[model samples]
Target: MGNKRICVPNKKEAPLFSWPWEDLNNYKYLLYGPLVSKVLYSIYKEEINNVDTWCLHILTLFVLRAFVHQLWIIYSNMLFLNRTRRINQQGVEFNQIDAEWHWDNFLILQAIVASLIYLSFPSLANLPIWDFRGILCCLVLHIGISEPLYYWIHRLLHCATLFQQYHWLHHSSKVTSSFTAGHATFLEHLLLCIVVGIPILGTAFIGYGSISLMYSYLLVFDFLRCLGHSNFEVIPYKLFEDVPLLKHVIYTPTYHSLHHADMATNFCLFMPLYDKLWKTINTRSWDLQNEISSRTKSRVPDFVFLAHGVDIISSLHAPFVLRSFSSIPFSIKPFLFPLWPFTFMTILVMWAQSKTFLYSFYNLRGRLHQTWAVPRLGFQYFLPFAAEGINNHIEDAILTADKLGVKVISLAALNKNEALNGGGTLFVNKHPNLKVRVVHGNTLTAAVILHEIPQNVDEVFLTGATSKLGRAIALYLAQRNVKVLMLTPSTERFIKIQKEAPLDYQHNLVQVTKYQAAKHCKTWIIGKWTTPREQYYAPSGTHFHQFVVPPIIPFRRDCTYGKLAAMKLPDDVEGLGSCEYTMGRGVVHACHAGGVVHFLEGWKHHEVGAINVDQIDVVWKAALKHGLNPL
Candidate 1:
């Protein structure tokens, strides 16, 4: 029979055997024979003919077998306990309400009950009904009875009324630790132990059984019970699917934990037979639930504006214009057709007319014929026309320059493919008065090209949003004495470039004081300076020139306050300043009833832009002052 020891709490001190380490030593004894084996060999050598020596050797072997069996059980228990303690100490609170009580007492009760059932089997042979058939019947009975009985009692415990008061406590711990397997109420433990034991014992009594078989089964069962509670995740359950006999066995740790976690399901305790027979098996649910929970916890919204920035440039603005032209009607579109018919005829006529008629009407006090010979200065214009906004700003700047006979240079547009190619130069021959170049190269090559440009290039007009290329260009130009004009669709990018501009410049490039430096001529333009294409295109139109208003140039000061606040202006500014200003060879003049004077002053000083007006005002003022034509 297997050994049994009662553990009374504080009533008697159980022998302290150094626990886990002692368990390891016992395992060594099993693998290599015990110290008594050598002594027995010596005895056999000294007295070869003695009958007592043979009997002693037999006794030693029996003792050794029992010791090894008990030692294996103790070792397995030690492993489970050690793992449980470590997990518990990690501050991993098990949701199970009665975790402490169950871990300490439930397994002990089950072990005791299992031992009793095993020991009781030998007594069946002593009874009046003893035969070979009876013994064979008893072995089968013991093996099959406990599992079904355990299942029924387990199912009953899952009823709502019983679960809330008792079973829920066992399932509260979400992450099932080693010790948590046995963590359940004492009454629940007692019910499981008694219900399972009665059936197995009843069968053992009905059929006579050998005590030794009973002993071996019980010991192995207890050892396996401890193994099931071990934290080691070594076993692969998939390996058992092909083994017909082993596949039907009771209580794999994996299968059992699922039952404890969700009592409403997986009611079978020892085997999945009842679960499968009743159509209650759900092996994949636990993993599925875990996956879904993780996904839910990490969910991110699709329209997070802060992370990706406003889609004004690509999604909202560009699509609106593209769709408007695609849907425009054809009847009234001929009136908006180009008057000129050559390769560059349409563009040249658009530039000349916009300057002579539209610009003169807006800026000059007199009629166009009288103001035809008026002298004007010239200024650099950076028009970013690629994705969200169109090339209308370039058209507008050209018109203004042509009316005043100012010099203009158009930068070639970089498309998505060209930009991605990362090494090439694009040349446009359409406008003889303008020099248009597009840089399509790797960042280092682009940087090198920018560095080669002479420092004497006084003012720079930059178009496009804050990209790595754009930022690098701004930083490089700022290091020289060149003034920068920045324009973009992204407000965040605009803000970031503004902050990085000064630091990016060379430290000793200019030793001028802050006031003098502020007046040292620099301009950055940003915003929807021109009217949107949707305003001009018909719902089903086919032409690109039908885009309205070329592009509008508002002084930065005009839009800095109230509805158009690009960035907040200082409170001291009262109203519009002057309507005319000069920079380089250009003269910028505005007729709007806003802060045109501040814009003009900013143009002369080469300020980033008038805080309240469109940046186009700076370009106009600069061109008019320098006596250069955009055409």
Candidate 2:
């Protein structure tokens, strides 16, 4: 038989009726319901029918109950509100915002409302205002009316100008942790309280309840309000949510937190009715996990402004050009093709030719001006002559350095084989004062060289254009308190990269344009060489080089064969026979042989079983060596 599911009774169920209690309930209702009904019943029963005195007594009772209820309700709500504030304080440190503004405005508004209510209803004061019925009536009016009114006024305060001047102080706490709820100006608080309280009290007075009863009802409402605002969500009574009426009337702590986060929604105080009616209720579940994930996933670039600039240019320029082209007539556009294509080709050809011709022109100009020489006052000039391969310019550099009496350091040509074949070393061999250094190997080693330069060396010269490597050298030299000067084909890329990747050289690194470098005494010729990938795969030098290979079958075979063969076998020969000894041998041999063969063959396909076994053995050996035993 299927297991039976246990059923439990709901806690809210109560007995239908009890004789004496029912009678008492009826008696209380009769006493509080109405004075006219009581008087009529007395007269019909012939019980002391003094109509004038009876009427006066009934009027007094009605006035007293109304007054008492109002007072009780107000007191109760205030206590509950204070309690919520206190609990919120325990959870976090409070920081008040716009203290003077909040207190002054809110408190003044409250005082004005309270004074008005007191002056308008003086007859309520003459009656037995301290009575239970009067207090209960007052309490009910305070909560029922005040809550909806507060929501409306509070929403109004969120209007642009009003919020900036007053309401913004209340919502300053964006995180809205527990303590943030009550951290508002006194004026703000007072205004809010009075706005809510006065309307509810007025409505209750109109409903014919004694003031005392309103006060009592208010006390209950205030207690629930405090519970709703408290960060603690411990509901002691499980049946509270089960009852339709009670559940609908009460607000939960989570409901209040949502109000703080999204101020425009969740305006109702005691219940969600006003919010629902006004279409301002926020019923969406808060997912903190998703919020955190989104924050972590967002990527903020290091140079955000530059990236933004690039985006703006790309967006604006393309649209502008497209619109300009679209406005032109189609027949006119076909006629303009000859001129447009010729102009485009001319520009492209000029750009390509300028790269080489520009460098040569500057080099020749420097030689004629006797500017390719370095001064003795600790200035090192790095001329990128060899990279551009203008031999006549390099000769000019040597002659200028010799005349200036400055030590010339050369960054040997990168294409050493070609340079040697071309007899470029003849000039270097002739200049006995010149020193040549060859930079080889990885980037880190280059960094190390820049780190260890002799202090006596006044300046360091780079033989090529300032690129990533050039920037690194500049930063390194700057750190060592050395000045760097570079000679390049042009200053365009150098200026751009320098701005993008700012080096904290602190005035140690300086860039001389090809024009300036040419005007100086000494110049170094640096040759430019393109990498294989840049030349063939990505002519524009844009794509990155990454090598990825598949997993090897040999590694997998090694794991499977190594693990299974190491397992403990049965001791009895007869048991081995029963276990199919020949089959077991064949399987083991196959795995071991397969692994060795694959290892020899250099197979690059993944083999899960062998990989698992090899991993198991490796881990086992490592653990054993480390004196770690699973048992």
Candidate 3:
């Protein structure tokens, strides 16, 4: 015990302390998040008075938290107010009804047995609170002391190399119970105590908080820790949903639940403030919470369509397929494949050049990624060939999709063309038992293309206007009193498509053109246009749909265009897969969006060959309402 409050941060460096500065709520205690670091770095900082005494203080807090935490675990189990599904590494979980209340009995004993190490330390107790202010100080100081250290260490624990070795023990409980809070290796527990206790000890040695406050902190921290790890969310996030800034201040059970479920984001100790700053916070934290815990079942995803590079530009998509073919085959060389070889990659090697066709490509490759959130998840698979260059591996991609419980599959790019008459018959005829519906994903693609045109713009310059997708987008906009500047390689073909769709373009203020712009329409939809790279140019804020693959000519460096699509989508979207990066691109074309669209409408055994004009708005509005927005 020593002197007065010794350390305070300078105004300039401490932005975290400032309220409403960057939409953060103002709390009375400005000093939080990294306050312990400020204190340790302050002028009043002191060396330990006695190493043994500091050691004894740490030991006492651990013992206190352990015993109290154990009692709360038992008490909480008795009440069982918030039991939830237990998640695991491989995406498998049991029903809540299937669970027995007493399954956690060994877990409590496990925690108690793990705490026996504290017996070796010298007896220490009776930490007392000196004053009324000390209680507040204790609460605030605990958060400040532990947050920074724990935040950094927690991030370290998530490092891929370290997670399996050290952190997986705690993550074993996907749906965390109170006992699971401290369920870590001794090293992890000791480190956790150090990080949490550092701030407490930092202020305590200065006599800022009393011994009673110190004990209170130990107990309070244990309670909150248990609460954070508690599977069910007790705090109504809706309580502060109206207050934008207040919503950002505190942590919720769902916040931590996401960490267990996804295992990639939400890596802060208390609040997600540090996570927000670091840009690692899951964009779908709340939606994921509801999706995972909600009683509703059919709303959950039945299937998801994931693919590698899609489309006919073998020049572009072939590289991804070729790489897959060059690697040791998944079916053939299961013994040689390294590191989770059997889990996600479902490969098939079909040697070509046997009188059927002429091509050097020997293998049709498919990758089905499994990032499980619940019983059914979306599959992330790879396209076999770049559009028309090699045989489309629709069957290979479909087989992997079937294995992942994918009920409906979107044949991205040329895969759609491979199906007879652009209908998914080739796949439907083969895989009858899987009941996998094959989708061109073109109508939804057309729907998304039409949606991408900005309201500020009077006219859209649609490229490849005569093509299947381009014609649909042009008519949808033209009919809605929007001026359409249709760009086509052939004027006659463009007019034929307009006449074919039976929607008169000229009467609807639609102007068919041959690659020249008028009216300075800044917003452009680059649909099905795959000329050389230089042909694709637009203003800085241009939003291009570019639904056809070999995607938008890889946009010139000097010219900037924002590729718009639905992002951080709500889980309710059928076949919605991981938002976490699975491939080279994050924002996908309308093809992927189409699978999600078809899944939601419950169109089993339905095939959308060429997108009709009438269905465009229905799909676009659905995508827009749920998750399709500018992100």
Tell me, by lDDT, which candidate is best: 3
Candidate 3 at 211: error in angstroms? 49
Which digits, one per residue and each the tens of the lDDT, describe model 3 over residues 411-518?
545445532224565556555676666677777767655655666667676766666777777777777777777776576676666675444545543545544463
> What is the number of backbone collisions in each predicted candidate, taken in the order shown?
72, 76, 11
lDDT minimum window of 10 residues, candidate 1 = 300-309
Q: What is residue 74's positional error in candidate 2, in angstroms?
A: 22
**Candidate 2's residue-wise lDDT over 219-286, tens digit each?**
45434544454443333334453564554465555566677767778777767667777898776512
User: Candidate 1, residues 1-631: lDDT per residue as tens digits?
Assistant: 0111223244433222112222242243332242245446767677543333333333443454344433432332232223322111112211221233224344334434443443554344333333355445644554466655666667776787666556654565554544444555566767755644544355455544434444444445444544444322323444454564554555455555455445555666445666777766667633433333233121111110000101112111110122121112111234233421431343345335433221111122211111111111111112223222222343333344444432221111122112321211112223434321221212322222343344566654443324444455555566565655544555565666666556645331222111222222333222123333321221221111110111233333322211111111122222111111111111211111112222223222211111111233343444334332321
lDDT of 2: 0.35
